[model samples]
Target: MLSEGQRIAGQYTVERYLGRGAFAEVYRVRHRFLGRQAMKVFKHVGSRAAAEELLEEAVLLSRIGHPNIVRVFDAGIAETPGGRSAFFTMEYVPAGNLEQYWAARGDRFTRIGEAVDLLIQICDGLAVAHGERPPIVHRDLTPQNVLVGFDDDGRPRVRVSDFGLAKRTDAFTGLASARGTLAFKSPEALRYRKGDSPAGDVWAVGAIAYLLLTDTLPFHDDSSPVAFFGVPRDAPPPSPQIRNPEVDDELARTVLHALEPNPARRAADAAELARLLRGWRNPETRQ
Candidate 1:
């Protein structure tokens, strides 16, 4: 583990530890000249083959450049007495992730309009990835992967992060099989049938919207830590309005539409979903 105050690549000065997952450890660091940043370094050091696999994440981040996506400032191999480790520096989102943002808000649900706007922001980022030549599908789309921050104007901003599970649409079969958190996965993904599609990502968007509105997952399987592990959420979940009466029918309908099990029937893509959210109107507020 890289300790606080450790310097990597002779440029970034480690400020403190941020997070750690099975594959990597993230540190909050300050570049000698670039200010504050988040640095992610692979945990394991072994075969050159393993290093290449881990480097793919940095490559993906470098390729997908969008304001709504986490920006990769630099990437390189760091040499230490132990060995060489691959690392990348990205924008440091101080507000943490969507999951943390939502949890801190207490029992009160985020305003319907605010939640819809946040979802639209997420869709904007997804649209960029889905628009690529071969289309990059983020097999994993959870609140944990959505970073929340503030812009220069001090307004809330969102950026999609963690592309480790992302892959080109054409190669989905080989890479995305049985990936992603079970709760956020589309039914098709759960069934391991064409699991990495724009439609599958759309489903995750719906699940996120549902969670934001109700503070509950669309489907849950208490029998296992993995929600809906083997059980398909064949039945449509009760409307988000059931939990938060403030969730109007228009918003509830949009969310449920995205959760549709049939990929063909869901929103055409993230762009389409964004449009729906943008067009949503509260009839009660009509003039």
Candidate 2:
């Protein structure tokens, strides 16, 4: 069902397979005219109706262009063995993903300076997504979706990927499945038919931070996604200090606030979360 060296839109040729998931297969590709690109051929859009939805996705992405978000160079369909289907050409992130990076170098991020740097980039990315007219929710912020690398200037860059599974505050994703990672899913998301909010993203980001600090995910377990959020009455908090004492009080508290079971108590949105992180970093203000 899958082939190689396939060209999409008669412009980009698949360089190699990058990764695969239930809904999409990402490939490293090069353009005949445009140079290098990461082509994600989404298996989800197999129908004529789904093919038409590309316009909205393109529009949505075009509206939220930020340095921290993955750049969408072009988006359109490439023919599959069956017929015309979906494919999107995006900026190729050379540094791979955050999980692999973090796993390969764990104790280094335990340093407050590096951890703070990574967190700020994530906040900036979330701010861009949440600042949309209707506010967008990533609905998933697991380590796999966050890509890390550096720019020509040697400054670290973190780009959030995979908007296909995301949702906006005012709308539901057209897909019929739950649209988020189980461990990162907020309490409401675990209980309801669908859950999407800026706070949800904040919580998921907090989960990522927790993992980095502790080197283990407390709530992440072998459970149906439904089971995790279904009974949130007794969800327990994981202590980063327990894992790494260097994970100072300020950062731990901020992370905990975002992980609150109730959305009302969570940071107002990604902006609020970013504001807290920024203010916490100011020594004079903290004093």
Clashing pairs in 2: none
* TM-score of candidate 1 on Cα atoms, chains taken together: 0.91
Residue-wise C-alpha lDDT for candidate 1, range 186-239, written one tens digit per residue: 877776545768888899999999989988988877346343443556656899
TM-score of 2: 0.89
Question: Against the hidden reference, what TM-scores do the models get?
Answer: 0.91, 0.89
Error of 1 at 135 (Å): 1.1
- Expressed as tens digits, the lDDT of each residue in 90-149 for candidate 2 is 889988888887777656544666666677788898898888757787777788988898
Per-model RMSD to reference: 3.0, 3.1
Estimate the lDDT of model 2: 0.75
Task: Name the regions of candidate 2 deviating beyond 4 angstroms.
Answer: 44-47, 171-178, 222-226, 232-236, 285-287
Stretches of candidate 1 off by over 4 Å are 80-82, 171-176, 222-230, 281-287
